[model samples]
Target: MSSVSIHPTAIVASGARLGANVRIGPYCIVGENVVLDADVELISHVVVEGHTHVGAGTRIYPFASVGHQPQDLKYKGEASRLEIGERCVIREAATLNPGTAAGGMLTKVGNECLIMASAHVAHDTIIGNNVIMANYVGIAGHCRIGDNVTFGGTVVVHQRTRIGAHAFIGAQSMVDGDVIPYGMAVGNRASLAGLNLVGLKRRQFDREAIHRLRAAYRMIFSNEGTLRERTEDAAELFKDDDLVQDVVAFITSASDRPILVPRNGQVASED
Candidate 1:
């Protein structure tokens, strides 16, 4: 007999693969193409459907929906997939959807993520490890969220946006563009505030490194020639700083959305 523990009221398709020590709680539904890796736990009333793969040690709270169809109008019932990495905690009512054909066919959430209640991660979204999506946050389709990113409650990220690692989005913000690594964005239509100094400090970044990053930030956001020119100059000046290098690289990369910067006449103060 299989070692998986499944409640009598749970509906698990025969074709679903449940690894040892997996637990399916009451009224939960596991679809035919689903795979729950070892130690995965679904609390009551969770629905994991479609071609979803839940990684080991992940715990999903009641009423969360995983691997559902894309909300995209262009999606046509294709066989796309959703992959959740290990040790994730998906809270109640969170919805994670699969990718659309036009988006390369997969939506992915990396390890150690905490997706708070009622958050919606739309089709084709790629979330990196250690991300935190606060309650009621909504990420539109095709967004790329990097590792260690933090989204405050009710923040809405537009489609195709790229949020770099260690970036912070303030509560109730509307993000429609690219946020550079270690940057802080705030406001309805988000604008770059400054470096996420508090975040970096909490993460144990060295003081000297933080100092250099602040200098680089000033150079990049200066009202100089063009953003490209400023970025190039910052890159050259901070070539020895790894964190600054990441910010410069993100700025220079080709993105579908424009880069987020401070609003006109608003200057970011040094940390």
Candidate 2:
């Protein structure tokens, strides 16, 4: 007999894979191809369908929808997947969808994440470890969110945007571009306000590293040459500083969208 505790009212397909100590609560549905790792718990009324995999020790609350089809019109029944890493807490009413073929056929949520109630992670989104998406945060398709990033409540990110590691996006912000690592972005359209100093301090980053990152931030955003020039200069000057290097690298990296800059200044190329 299977050691998994599946409620009598739950609908688990015969082909579904359930690991030891997995629990499927009342009225939950696990599809044929779904895989629930060891110690995973579905509270109630959850639906895990398609080719989804829930990692070990993750707990999904009532009414959350995992591994559903993508919302893209281009998705014509491709065999995509949604993969959630270990120890994540998927709160009630959240929905995570699989990727489209153009986005490499996988949507991923990393370890130790807290996806708050009513949040939506769309097709092909890649979320890193220890990330927190507050209630009603909606991440559009193909966005790459780095580790330790936090999105405040009701924030909406545009498709294909890249949010770097340790970035803090304030509540109700509309992110339409790339946010560099350690950056703080706020406002309706979301301008880069400053570095995430409070977050760095709370994470116990070394004093020297934080100081160097601050210096690099100032130089990068100063009213001078183009952002490209500033990024090159910062890369050369702070080559030894790991945190500063991250910021420079993110700026120079090829991206379809423009990088987010302070709203008070123009960030386009300077002649």
Best by TM-score: 1
Cα misplacement distance, residue 163 of candidate 1 (Å): 0.3
Candidate 1: which pairs clash? none
Candidate 1 C-alpha lDDT tens digits along 1-271: 2889999999999999988899999999999999999999999999999999999999999999999888888999999999999999999999999999999899999999999999999999999999999999999999999999999999999999999999999999999989999999999899999989899999999999999999888888888778899899988988989999999889999899999998883558746
Candidate 2 local distance difference test against the native: 0.93
Measured against the true structure, the TM-scores of the candidates, in listed sequence, are 0.98, 0.97
Show where candidate 2 strays beyond 4 Å. 266-271
Candidate 2 accuracy as TM-score:
0.97
Q: List clashing residue pairs in candidate 2.
A: none
Off by over 4 Å in 1: none
True-vs-predicted CA distance for residue 58, candidate 1, Å: 0.4
RMSD in Å for all candidates: 0.9, 3.1
Task: Tell me how far the alpha carbon of residue 165 in candidate 1 is from the true structure, in angstroms, after superposition.
Answer: 0.2
